[model samples]
Target: MAGGLVKYRHLSRDSAHRQALLRNLVTSLVKHESIHTTWPKAKEAQRLAEKLITLAKRNNETSRRRATGILYTPHDLLPKLFGELRKRYLERPGGYTRVLRTEPKSTYDQGASAILEFVDGPKDLRFAMTAAAVARDRALGRKSNELTLKNRSKVLRYRDNGEKAFDDMVKRIGKLDLAGVNKGGADKSGEAVA
Candidate 1:
């Protein structure tokens, strides 16, 4: 009820989910200087990444605090943000990042995906990859094959007693191959293959 008028991508997730997405994307962008994600996600992360870069440019206590609240770990994030990235882009007057579309689209959702990278940065990524890939690439000073799961479930759901019986029945039926195997009985088709 508080923000009923507000508008944002639902992404089939609740408020907390959206916020977490933003935080992770921004963090990745800072650490990697580039990231690949769905088109919509890239667009949304661009807004936040630019703002964070602007804060890095400011390089003040208050700005650092604001960034840390969103970024987590002021010591780690703020230093690199205000130090290296800030120095690199200090002369630029905004438009800090660019989103380039990945040809052939994405395999996951079949929606357009993009690589969002800092201006005057690397531009020849062969595939659209997750932010974790970008981070690993940075750490290794070259691309790495490592992958990290982003959306891990925080809640566990258990079936009730009634549901458990149906689940068990389905599992048993799944293993009962319907053809090309003997079940200690004749074919129920009332016929045989020659």
Candidate 2:
């Protein structure tokens, strides 16, 4: 029945090549806090990224060595990974990385693409999306829906001073011309255009 089969995507690469590719991806992810790539690659990298974060959280010699082995530029990234990222994710239990499917980034490659990012970081996509939703709801004079409410909670759950951050984002988005109000700086209700 193949009940205990070890499953992993090969991504059309030999073992050594695949390992190197994953290491590079994880290194970039750690440096930038987010990365965009093919869905399969992003999914595979997410596994390694989660493990790296777990290692950082441990903050021990063996864990640091293991993480260094996985990362390409350990010298440049180790401090950030062990210090900032470790502290950032210390409170969370699991699910450190998120893979969000996106349209193909290039016309040549029609394959599914995605963005891989760490949760609760400054560049969290879901957080910005949730704040935008809240702003739109306010601008439209409508209450937030159940899904929006749930997403809001998820975005704010682990964040420190989440309410303040969310309010700030909503205000920032509100200042933009989100709805039909004053489109293109014409001021739709103006008496005349000079």
* Candidate number with greatest lDDT: 2
Candidate 1 root-mean-square deviation in Å? 18.9
| Ten contiguous residues minimizing lDDT sum, candidate 2 | 179-188
Tens digits of per-residue lDDT, candidate 2, 42-136, equal 99999999999999999999999999899999999999999999998899999999999999998996999999999988999999998888888
* Candidate of highest TM-score: 2
The 10-residue segment with the lowest total lDDT in model 1 = 151-160
Candidate 1 is scored at a TM of 0.56
Instruction: Give the TM-score of each candidate.
Output: 0.56, 0.90
Clashing pairs in 2: none
